[model samples]
Target: MISRLSRELSPHLTYHSLYHTRDDVLPAAARLGRASGLNEDEYLALTTAALFHDTGFIDTYEDHEAGSIAIARAALPDFDYSPAQIDRIADLIAATRMPQRPADPLQELLCDADLDLLGRDDFMRLNRALLKEVRHYSHRPVPDDTWMRDQLRFIEEHRFFSPAARTLRAAGESHNRALMRAALASTNGANHAAGGLA
Candidate 1:
């Protein structure tokens, strides 16, 4: 079932988002397994939700959470997942939507995994790569300073829900902020030089 979903979903999604998230998702879910409240079925639901959480990015970048929900609904029929499990998975995937304020621990785990990179070690580099992905697909060239500012705004606005992610990934968040300020300064310096030379 996992293989079938991976095969169908991989083709449409860009590699960058998948590459980083795939490495972290299962491990994060495994860690979440250690938590007390989640039972076995709930664990499976969380794992399934984590796996397909980003699948919506395959068909479209904007509102891929809905896209992921649609993908899971379509693909799960063959797997014969119980209706309750299906609903759980769908809810978990949808929990990753922006403006997400998860009400329960399970939803929080999936949300943290989905936005896990916000706390990643290579955040600055990854941020550049994400900007590049957008540029490639949307044909919108984001200047370094502009990209940095956007990333800074996003970092300020968002945070990881899990304690592990927050504790481990905080450096990346701070580093990205510093990188953004530098980029803004550099862009302004270049503009000032151009005007002075003219």
Candidate 2:
């Protein structure tokens, strides 16, 4: 899976690359899973979901969760995953869809793990990468002011579903929010200055 992602994921995916799944989301799922007291089966399902969550990006960018689920459904049976287990894994992967409405505990854990970076110190670095990726796919530049405002709004609106994520990431999320606000103000000021000169 890792090799497939490394080879097949589009170069345009700076943020959603294989590195994101392997380096960020997978580890985060394990960390949060341990903290949340997941049983062995639950942990295995959650980790599997995390591993395949963004793999849809290998074939398609939009609505990739569906792609992920299809891949998981096809692949898990080969690994001896039971039908019910594959269904659970599929549900967990689907829970990560945007406007993330996780209806169960494992789903919550997977959702939180998918977005763990929002509360981490590296939020801006990854945020920038996402912006770049978006620009590449959208084929247009996102103005600094607009992008900053959108990011601030997203952070302000986002909530971690798992207790472990809330405990570990809430403060970091707040800090990142403040940083985003400051950056937005700075960007607005710069744009205003440029307009005044014009």
Which residue pairs does candidate 2 place in steric collision? Answer: none
Q: Residue by residue across 72-128, what tens digits does model 1's lDDT show?
A: 898887888987889889988888787788878888888776666666666666666
Per-residue C-alpha lDDT of model 2 across residues 1-198, encoded as one tens digit per residue: 899999999988999998899999999999999999999999999999999999899889899999999999999899999999999999999999998999999999999999999999999999999999998988888887889999999999998988999999999999999999999999999999999999
Candidate 2 residue 128 Cα shift, in angstroms, is: 0.5
Candidate 1 global CA lDDT score: 0.72
Off by over 4 Å in 1: 1-17, 33-37
Best by lDDT: 2
TM-score of each: 0.80, 0.98
lDDT of 1 at 188: 76
What lDDT score is found at residue 164 in candidate 2? Answer: 95
Give me the displacement of residue 185 in model 2, in angstroms: 0.5
All candidates: CA RMSD (Å): 3.0, 0.7
